[model samples]
Target: MTTQVQSGGMVNTTLMGGGALLVVGLGLALANLMTGGHASFNSGSDGVTWGLPVVNYVFFALTSTGLTLVASLALTFGNKAFYPIAKRCVFLSLITLVAGFASLALELGHPFRMLFAVPLNFQVNSPLNWMGVFYAVFLVLGVLKFMKLHASDWDSDTSKQVGLAALVTECLAGGMLGMAFGAMAMRPMWYGTLVPLYFLLTAACTGGAFALLMTYLTYGSESAMPEKVRALVQGPLPAALAAVLGFTILVMGYQTVIGLWSNADGMQVWDHIVSTPWFWIEAGALVAAFYLLVSRSSLMVAAMLIILGLFINRYEFVIGGQLVPLFKGTWVAGMISYTPSITEWMLTVMAFGIVLAGWAFGEKAFNLSDAPKE
Candidate 1:
């Protein structure tokens, strides 16, 4: 017996539940769009432009990039220890990127127009344009890579080549996503070389965390996993997470210190940021997660904490950067306060629902555990 790993009942239930969430969320989102348009969102015309939707976009986008980078360890670098999970990582990357794009489509005023407008009116000097182009390429490459992997049953030289290309594309796309914020000269808080580097770092952390999380969810426990796969999970996975978390902490600490010391125009936003309980909570969660990983306490707990903290971190980074009004004493007086509307919340639910349902379906349909032959 091959230790029948398919938990059919559980997988089916998850699929149905996720599908229900997807329907409910999409119905609400469409209703909102039909009624009030983008005005339904909490984002104002003057103060806060990018709101929760953008945060959601960044969260999923970076996470997808992270998964691609993680998968590259095996596909591109030929790391045998990582082979078992590489297929899952690539599949999740595709699903999550689709989710991110869906959220962005909901956010944009005219989503379909972008399909043609971007290429027709390409602006080389614009970081946003480059970000869009890179991501578009990345999405296409991701699809091709997944197709190759699936067709070859996760073993092919051609798939490896595509994986290598995907790794490079993801780096460019991830960096561009950061540059989309860092390149904004008007937003002092977001402008810096650190933003892109931080994005890449967090991408790794989030990607690794998600991969670990899904592995645990699928296997239920270490004993359920194949002997060799379990060894890889216990040894290499947590070790990689630990190393990335260490670097992430250092970068976050330095970013905070720099924010505190800088007397730039929008730097005052940090004052408000440091005062909030969420800020400390975000930092605390990462610290706890790091400790858990190093202490060999629980990889599951660490993964959950890292995901939670990174979500909050993304929320803060997106909203906090815009809190300080560009023009003082105008219609916007002090720090702009924004609360995500129910519509925005529903969109987020929709994104999660899509990911949950897709992942569950993939698990039930595909042999995600089939390790590549040496």
Candidate 2:
């Protein structure tokens, strides 16, 4: 009998879906906490302690960095096309940033220590320690920027200054994240100063792709998108996306070739990775994203593929880094295997759920529409 959907029905639907994800996520988290931290998980050995949590953390954190930087650039440049989505981008950044921290929390031996100890205890030399500090600063700046944009006019000089501050802090946070792992020379795959720079570029690509997708979803129709919005998505986004993809492909290809050629214990992990089904999935999604962007096909499809590819990349980066057991010089009998515990899967769902809830709430509360009414 109730065939007609009410106004804001879609938002309600998203809210409900997000709520379900949150419940499942929280329930599993509580269960894991009570049971004492992923005891059921098979992390292979001491060589592979980190798993899905690290992957999820890196994936969300990188995306957060991307969104914060993109939104700030939009504000700083005063590009009318990019202006409309700045607030949304900032809000999404905050959401993903918090989610990233949550994922990391789950991975920790004592998750509660993150709240106070992270701030009070200073490991000045550790990149990971510095990363936590940078993340906190980035979070504060994001919240400040979001509040400014939400409560005041977008054109205010104060907002621009806040945006700039947020941008600088985001770069610091993102760079520290990459360096946290890259500084580990023992893990040859992750080593190098170039890693931070690579993260910055990829963050741009991720942010651009994500913003484009959100634009398509929120605007409803092509006519709904302002001329400037169209230019932002169809112009800069595609070009940037293509270029970033090209660079990523080149780097990854070089890594793969060198890994195979070396056939050392560390590099030998690539042999196992290349043979896995996920490798093709990651490659296919990346190729599809590139093709869609270069061809100027469906921006939505391209965005989806890009996000998927990036997520898979995070998984491979984190997991593959530890697959080959580093037992002095002797090779292990078999490859280290890891399958995410149920709790890990639930937390991953919870992370995306938080993103959905934030997006829906932002749309509902801020009237995040492109209709030119506000």
Q: Pick by lDDT: which candidate is best? A: 1
The count of backbone overlaps in candidate 2 is 1
Kindly list the per-residue Cα lDDT of model 1 for residues 83-147, writing each as its tens digit: 77887798889888888889899999889998899889888988778877777888888889877
lDDT of each: 0.84, 0.75
How many residue pairs clash in each candidate at the backbone level? 0, 1
RMSD of 1: 2.0
**Candidate 2 weakest lDDT stretch, 10 residues:** 1-10
lDDT of 1 at 325: 86
lDDT of 2 by residue, 166-207 (tens): 888888888998998789898886777888887877777777
Cα error, candidate 2, residue 301 (Å): 1.5
Cα lDDT over the full model 2: 0.75
Q: Give me the runs in candidate 2 sitting further than 4 Å from their true place.
A: 1-10, 221-227, 328-332, 369-374
Clashing pairs in 1: none
